[model samples]
Target: MKFDLTEERQMLQDSLRRFLGDRYTTARRNEIIDSETGMSAEIWSQLAELGVIGAMFTEDQGGFGGAGFDIAVVFEELGRAGVVEPFLDSALIGGRLLAEAGQGEKVEKVMEGALHLALAHGEPGSRYDLNHVETTARDGVLTGRKAVVMNAETADLMIVSARVSGDVADQDGIALYLVDKGTDGLTIQGYPLLAGGRAAEVTLDHVRGTELFGADKGYQALADVTALATVAQCAEALGAMETATALTKDYLMTRRQFGRPIGTFQALAFRMSDLLIEMEQARSAVINAAGYFDTDQRDLYVSGTKNLMGRAGRLVAEEAIQLHGGIAMTQEYELAHIAKRIVMADHRFGDTDYHLERFIDLSAA
Candidate 1:
């Protein structure tokens, strides 16, 4: 299972890396985070113009006819830049939801960059179970609440997952609906996360929406979407780990203590070597998951990748901070941004603990 990128993929990765280097910076990132929405509309438009938003969609929807791996490459570059454009939420999660749900109009609108989209999947009771939704949709009305909805404030279209009225647990009763933002009886209260990203609490008081997708092949699309998004996150985590480790290595080489560079200290150098080993393992798992995404064995690979990458991301971030001393926590340092985002990424989709149990379950099955 070799996961080597083709020449085309390598070219795409290089282009995205250059674009992020030239366009996104620490100052601009801080400014965007300080804004009310914690994102930049102009930057998002620029990304759309560059075809970053629609890179994973088919050409029928005005996209570039790319795959999940292509989107993952872009995500890695975004992670290296510490960007908060909600690209993963809008382009990867929301756009894929629309496509799987067969919302042709919504997919077209989002692909054209005319409308931003968000997915309402997490709920208080679900506790990171993507299918354990309590929200209910009946008679064109949706009710219940969602928490930790990303990009809720800026999205024009919302894809909501809800339990079909009178459904059983672990069953195929979950349905997805399309609701326009500002619809009557729908309320969104949002705030910035500890990371640079933003999330919201969504409440639907009998909110009305059109059913976009129902249980197809036993509501399997939910799992597929989450798996696909997790692979993208693995890509981001790989980049973050690489960047943080490189920065720490450079700092250790230049910063002198006790008449020698800190990197000369065997203790710190060995720890960094361990981190590199974990990062290489994570890279392999991420690329393998991407390649196996559409196969019947996808869940196994996804769980394994999530577990490995989640640990690598958390470990690299913590190690980066520890090596940098107090300056690492300061907002003025790029390491701080990377650390926070990495911590957030650790919990996104599912945390290490969550993925461990998921991996065990899949393997047992």
Candidate 2:
């Protein structure tokens, strides 16, 4: 299959790249990371004006291109720039769930970047299990705690997962609810993440929420939304790996050893070649997962793609740092931040071992 972006997607990619290149410098990103909110409302509004957020949803959801490629294109650019905005939380996962639940007006606000939403699903010990929901919801009341909820502190609303009937880890009886921020019985403890973003630990004590769709329908929606997020994350990792590999190649060409460029050395040249090959393989896997997202085999492809990306991201990040020596370790260097993001991306959604296990189980079944 052809791995090239469509004309419209290509245009979107180009425009986003130009915008980020011109505005989102490393200094600006560091400033945002150090800010009280850990993000920039001005930048968020600018991105919305550029239609970056809207392009991630379908026309029905107030976006023109909600396909897998559309998500891949937008996130790849975000990763390349090391952006810390909550677009992934607000647009991809939260917006998709809201749209699936028929909350069209809220989704429109999300698409316009007028509102921010987060998915508070993972608990303290859930470990990567999408079905491990220990939070309880009954009679419009929610009670539980969610761990490491991305962008939760800044979200105007949160889509929380809770169990209505079945035991924890059961796929059935899982439900999602929309909880407005600052509601009674809700508390959020926010902290900065290692990868230049903010996350929160949220506790809900008899917090009342409006259910999004019926309780019986949330399991499938959560599964589908998480799968899509995993695929988009893989694309982001691929972009970061691409940047890391290029930086490594440039370092090899410029850093001299034995009165000559290190790239001229046979061993370093071979290592660079290997990294390039692995990056290409990872790219192909992302394209395959994106292309198959609408098919019955989407879960399989997403699992396999995430597994490949997790391993590849680790390899690329480590090798890039090693090849660059001390300069790569500094926070001021672009490579340091990009490599950190790539390494941390594996821990999100699922890690290499988790996805490998899932892939094996699915293949056997």
Candidate 3:
């Protein structure tokens, strides 16, 4: 019930805040985001050098002995700075899964001073149910299509989920596999998204890999890890909302209309005030949900965080854009950056509707 970060977590947050101050800026972020690879290997390597890429893994997994809250702290810092590195895709999803599956050898190699693995779980048909994996794995061969996989095109490796000899919707038969990039029969097609980030359609035409985690209730692992992932995302979304609100407020203060600053106008000021309140609520939900995850509350906390953050993130993003007027939509303005991050927040684990339904199902049970 208490929402306070311990000394260790605060230290982690402060370290990331300092590191991001020196390493990332709007200009640097823009350059990396618009680059040929749509990411910065140099920055990613630097994160590894700082031991942040593996900050959430355990010592047994060859990591620096960290946890979900540590990872969430990093995500908050990244969101505050608009850094476009692959910590979420790599360390959170792919690396965490491998670490949990007891793939120490792979981690020792792949996670050595870098973490940029991708999760190839989503199919064109699966929507947000990760258990609904249509990708097939039989006799060491994987064959199926993955759509809009974040960081797949540039990741060093991928942790893919596949159905093993059963219907796609069966939760018990799914397995997680580790596949090297550019393997034979793996076709990757990259494209730019509306948010200017990159995602790829990955087709595994009988691709082969070793099974890292099989049908031994890894679904529980997946659920727990994904809950942590969702809460971390909510933190990021809250950060984005805070940033957008600041930008809007600053613009209002400086932008003149009739005879004084537009911020002084009652109508606009009230709207900004409302947004500030909403942003704080969203932030509280983020911290509370994160604390719940850390405390091992399995059922309601994850869905609660997703719901609160989904609504708050969307509301703040939309209001910030509206308050900024036409300038917000244009790429020339910085508000667009926060806005894009907010827009992309919907697909992080699942959209608001998806999580709400999940909450309902859990409540019913």
Candidate 4:
């Protein structure tokens, strides 16, 4: 019956909010987004020192928290501040994958923000399918390109997936390797993302890598880590939606029309009410997904959550823009950045259509 966050989680949320509020102004976030790296090393270090990175992992993994709620809590704050840092890449995905590979020291460096990690799994045309790894490994070298390898440009290490045994799409043939940043035959074409952050098109030509897991264990680990990523993303979208609605509300309340606040109009009031309802529903889905965590039932909840949240996020973004007009689209404002983040979240991990099909498939099973 208790739907509230645990006391520790609440405290973590408060601390993150306070820190970001004090230091991460809208202008500062915009500057980071505009930077070549699309992130800030100094800010990243501050967050790590505040225990933000460590909060995303379990105690057994040398972190104080690793529950699904823990991830949701941390990511929600990140999104609220429009943080473009690689916390999701470093902690929820990479840190956990390192733990799975028994690379505890690397994980420690990650928690300390001394290292960054990216998972180079999705290849060209992969389109959010975790099993569609076309990159190949042979004779101790990896070849092929990884698409949208988030944070790979800055990552000291990458967890690359390659097919070692069967067809590219075969679930059983995928393996994972740890490739160092400066490895021979490894190349990255880094680019800033639309919503903020850096990703790369990583090319490997017989690149040497330390084997992390063979096909036997690789697929399951990749799947689990991806599911965790999906959960974190959905929580982030919820935070972005919160910002969008708040911004829209402020605009409506303050922007006078015909000598009256536009928010006083019944039609606008009804629409704002509808947006709030949708947001609450999205929040419910996030809570449900977080509760399932990484268990067998996790896929079901995550799929449902991602599907619903994606749709709701799009609606929130579009509606907020309509209410706020052209100003909402300008980069000078916080809502513009927040709205973009909300809308783009649907495209990552899996989109609404993908997760809806996945949810139905799981339900039938």
lDDT of 2 by residue, 206-279 (tens): 99999885668888998899888987899888888988998899999999979999899898888899899999
Mark the 10 consecutive residues where model 1 has the least summed lDDT: 163-172
Instruction: Report the C-alpha lDDT of model 1 over 213-270, residue by residue, as the tens digit.
Output: 7754325777777888888888887777778888898987888899999889999889
Candidate 2 ranges beyond 4 A from true positions: none
Q: In lDDT terms, how accurate is model 4?
A: 0.90
lDDT of 3 at 293: 66
lDDT of 3: 0.78
Q: Estimate each model's TM-score.
A: 0.95, 0.98, 0.93, 0.98
Off by over 4 Å in 3: 1-4, 109-111, 294-296
Runs in model 4 lying further than 4 Å from the true structure: none
Query: Per-residue alpha-carbon lDDT of model 4 for 82-108, expressed as tens digits?
Result: 888988886679999999888899889
How high is the lDDT of residue 365 in model 3? 78
Q: Any residue pairs clashing in model 3, and if so which?
A: none
What shift in Å separates residue 67 of candidate 2 from its native position after superposition?
A: 0.4
Rank candidates, lDDT, best first: 4, 2, 1, 3
Scored by lDDT, model 2 comes in at 0.90
